[model samples]
Target chain A: MPWAIAAPNTPPPPTWGIFTPGTVGQFFFVIVYSAVIYWLISRAKAGMPVPEIRKIAGLDAFDEAVGRATEMGRPVHFTPGFYAFSSHTLAAFSILAHVASLCARYDTRLIVTTLNATNHPVLEEIVRQAYLEVGKPDSFNREDVRYLSGYQFAYTAGVVGIFHREKVAANFMMGWFLGEALVIAEAGALAGAIQIAGCPAVVQLPYLVASCDYALIGDELYAASAYLSKDPVMVGTLIAVDWFKMFITGLIVIGVVFANLGSKAFMNFITK
Target chain B: MRRQLPVWLGFIAGMLVIIARYFAFPGFTQVQKTLDNWAMYSGAAAFLMGMINLTIVHKTNIQRRRENWGASLVLLIAMFGYFIYGLFTGPDDKLFVSIFNATISPLGSAMFSLLAFYMLSAAYRAFRMKTLEATILLAAGLIGILGNAPIGAAISPWIPSARNWMTEILNTAAMRAVTIGTALGAYAAMVRILLGIERSYLGGRGD
Candidate 1:
């Protein structure tokens, strides 16, 4: 019989299988994020009436707090809350940027303490940039940006020490805080620092509200950047997010109505 | 030239990462992976910078014979001790494990427990019936706190049920409203960052 040509039964490389799905998903997420971001930017540029953000008592007090520090001639302590790399921290950074600018403009010393070593460089950059923006780059002191420690309590202790020693006139805590929130807040209070604290951590909010002169509750922290910048993209995204919330609310209402009527189908649909 | 290069690079890299995330293109995906790796490494590298900054400040204080040199010495010792322990000892080592469990763990727990006392004091101060809002907040907080504790259940069976109802109906609703509002705000800010309208992050030198 003539020689038969056999087809190769070799399997595709395992590497290909591993690479494909992850890459695709990542790509998809990035594109969606970009599109939303772009839409927001365009809206901002077009001068869309950025929905008026309700004045947060905490944010309003920021100026007063800074002014108090200036009058007292004491350094203002600012700790951008715990998570160094999170979006919340970035938002906090934006607020810090603005606050730093205010500090520079007022010719007051601002002391920023970072919990994580990794955050130090970024924070230093943020402070420097803020000063530069305010036309006081020369006044941006490297000593003012301190790295306390990575450990939570260690960081808190360091901050409290700074509070007492420096007699911080104002304290701004913005970011992802846990139990240390109250410790720092209480310390600030004891130091007679006009404290403004903003964090998304629900548990910490009450503590902040109680001890701090001003408390940015829940989502107000997220709104800080947009509120400070008045950037259009931020405004547009805010609108879109509201729409999303409405949809969620509608769903909740429907589910509640069906549950009350004892509709198994509706209940099951919601439970799923 | 220095400033412009960084700006362009940041813009291009940022867009690439975003696009790569959105699309399934291999090239884009690779770029993103590379960027992510770079971010991780860069983040790690920042530790050295932080150490340098810390040392500089503390050393300067010591050299200047600044006030509270004793505290600085204690801090330096503690830092070095922790670093040495972490570096040298494996988790399997009894001494290391005990130190972690007994000393570190308890200290952390104690710090967290400290909040309870502060919170009570702070709440007492904040919940003064000064305004209508304050009065409502006080009432809600009282209910919420009682509901969460065991004493509320022991005091009255109905109290727990009432607390549960309040949490489910009122607390949930209020929290949800806040969440929605925050989500919107966050989305807006993210959009600004992506569009490069928020270049204040790049520093004042714009590098």
Candidate 2:
């Protein structure tokens, strides 16, 4: 009975208690990456030329979609999907501002739907400001910036209803999404609305690609703010990100090599 | 001041969070908890604002007798009715739970069930033999379907192995690449925001 008892195993104590346990590698990456990004940003701030961003067809279609909506005399519909103050939603806000300005300049109605109540106020402010910036403050309608529902499917139903009722000429789906991605995109397709969808959600990308006229795949959604604004600092940050991606690719290759050689040393080092 | 205040506040909070993540500083956990609680409280307050917005929008529709005014009225009634009832009964009340389970749950499921038809239509549109990429996608999709079905194994052993390789190797590798790219992009965006460079979220271009 005494032999049946097991010894307790615990992690080793932290050295110097400076960094969080098991996060040394992460901290190293953060410092190096931030340093690289800041260096590029400073260069951009000093008016040095940075590498140009490649063309994203989905983003390029923004003006065309807005123009189509204007010519058709129909409202442009946009949803930032269901998220609360995420990076995806922030990117969505930039896109929303661009779309809102286009709508204001064209004197076309823009309808925005939000699943999260928290985003409603910010979205309304963004839309209102966009209109104001474009010298069409009077065209900003508070009612059009709607908070649909917190429930996923309910939001989908509401968006689908709007698509049919308002006869939306163009639909833009941006931000984080779930199962509702395809339903909304397909509903827009059924409504004959030219659709543009973007999200970092991998599982939902195929649906957007198949159903929407154009889709921003993966990091393209993150590239949106820089792509739309064409700000040098943002562009510089994107280039830094590309370099970091290369760094990660290198790590992946090394990890693969170690794995094939039957060694867990690299894996443990990474997890450290 | 109106604009600069938010950016400064954002920078402070973002730095604090980053520090807390990387270092084991005293009181950091408590500060993080407080920040989370503040976020929840802010969300609650925003819910009230959203309620007001809904009422205003729908009330206007009903007052002006717009198209689908009846639907608007119905929506307002249902929303307020359930809200008031929940307020009185509490969320854990048996009747409240039962009502939610009976109506909202089933409705959500029904809405989700519509995805099957949507997927079919989307697949049909995407699988058209128009381009090389489309042809590859169509062929892969057919193989994937066959591999999943029992009849596929009866036809050929290679079909299942091919499907497994496609999903396990090709699909997973692509997914990992996308996931990594997304993480890097998000981190970069966060850096820009924290450094007070990207002010697009504050209704301004990066100035």
Candidate 3:
């Protein structure tokens, strides 16, 4: 009686010791999505043309930011926001790799301040490798990749201090940010640093966009690694994602239309 | 091996979670639960790493007598002193709680208060009538500000209605679109990681 009341008007899912019945749709979607990605990856590997991702202004500014620091003989500052290991941080790492390489090539100083300690060692290694890749391994300073306070506002204070003390030429703030977003970016702006910022946090997006010279909005932060790397595999994966978005859009449209026609069939299929 | 090991582990763990989520397989729930616990444990372990790093970095600053070395010394004293005190008295102890409330809480709040000033500065720069979009943004910002204040309703009934429409309809729609796009982007990123294509997290170049 309790089970019936809890799941009123719903029959039990038929299971054959395999896929969960209700999850069949999601499972199939994942398989199709993965297959599409893999196929695109293979095509990219074979040098086949894929849809070129549009140029992102924030990513395009990376080299320019590093070069400005070099020309001005000032250091460039970067932080991957206040989060620990997450997709956003991973994307930030890709940007850092490119920035480090550019700094190495130009012999400009790059100072990385990390809020998450676990990300510190990884960031250090990326900077070191980037310098090595650019044939300037000796120029790499481990001390420059600093692990600042883990507390959100404390990290912001540290970044603000760096901006004021070092008088950085360029500042890059990428990854997940929260209330502290404007504090750091505005500090950079006040210090006369050219700033580029990206964050997936919607609430903080306005602050970053308003303060930073260039801001990567929404998924742009995720797209950054692929955009900057210009690697075939990465680019291919991005294209596949776009295709899947179109598919989802189509489903949404269909569901809307069916609902308008007084049919719950499509809606039930999706909700199932 | 240093690089490859992490990639394999990530792939394995990712697949396990995916299967456990979508498949009616037995024992996978237990596996997922175990992995989640491991993740929690590692995160706690990483905090200790953060402490060690903080000490080393600040110690160097003090040794070199770097600019603001005094601040570093104070930070170290505060950090370790508070830590040791907490260890002995426990976080629930009145003294420990009082110290946190006295120092860290107030300091954090003070830093957060700076955001209002920063926001004003940012808004000043952003609201400049340099472009059409900026002009629209300025209009929207004014509306949003007015909508939140008591005087806005006094100005005109329509002003509040317009602000409500903008916030409820326009802002919500835009935020939802961004949220959708971000979800897809994150999914793509995860796919890359699972496939061993996105290796930047391994402290190397992405494939």
Q: iRMSD per model?
A: 4.2, 1.1, 2.0
Candidate that would win on lDDT: 2
Question: Which candidate ranks first by DockQ, i.e. highest?
Answer: 2
Off by over 4 Å in 2: A1-12, B204-207
Pitting candidate 1 against candidate 2, the one with the higher DockQ is 2
Ranking by DockQ: 2, 3, 1
Taking all chains together, each candidate's TM-score versus the true structure is 0.80, 0.96, 0.93
Q: A1-272 in candidate 2: lDDT tens per residue?
A: 87786878865565347777888888888899999999999999999999987889999999999999999999999999788898899888888888888888899899999989999999999889888888878888999999988889988999999999999999999999999999999989998999999989999988899999999988888888887888898899999888988999999899999999999999988778
- Better TM-score candidate (1, 3): 3
The TM-scores of chain A alone, one per candidate, are 0.81, 0.93, 0.90
Against the correct fold, how does model 3 do in TM-score?
0.93
What are the Cα lDDT values of the candidates?
0.75, 0.89, 0.86
Error of 1 at A37 (Å): 6.6
Tens-place lDDT per residue, model 3, B1-207, is 877888899999999999998877668978999998997788788778778878988899999999999998998999999899989988799988988788777889999999889899999999998999999999999988998898889998888899999989998988877887888888788898888888876654643
Model 2 chain A weakest 10-residue run by lDDT:
A10-19
Candidate 2 clashes between residue pairs 3 or more apart in a chain or in different chains: none
Residue B74, model 2, lDDT: 97
**Candidate 1 off by > 4 Å:** A1-40, A47-51, A231-244, A254-272, B1-39, B81-103, B145-156, B204-207
How does model 2 score on DockQ?
0.77
Model 1 chain A, poorest ten-residue lDDT window?
A: A13-22
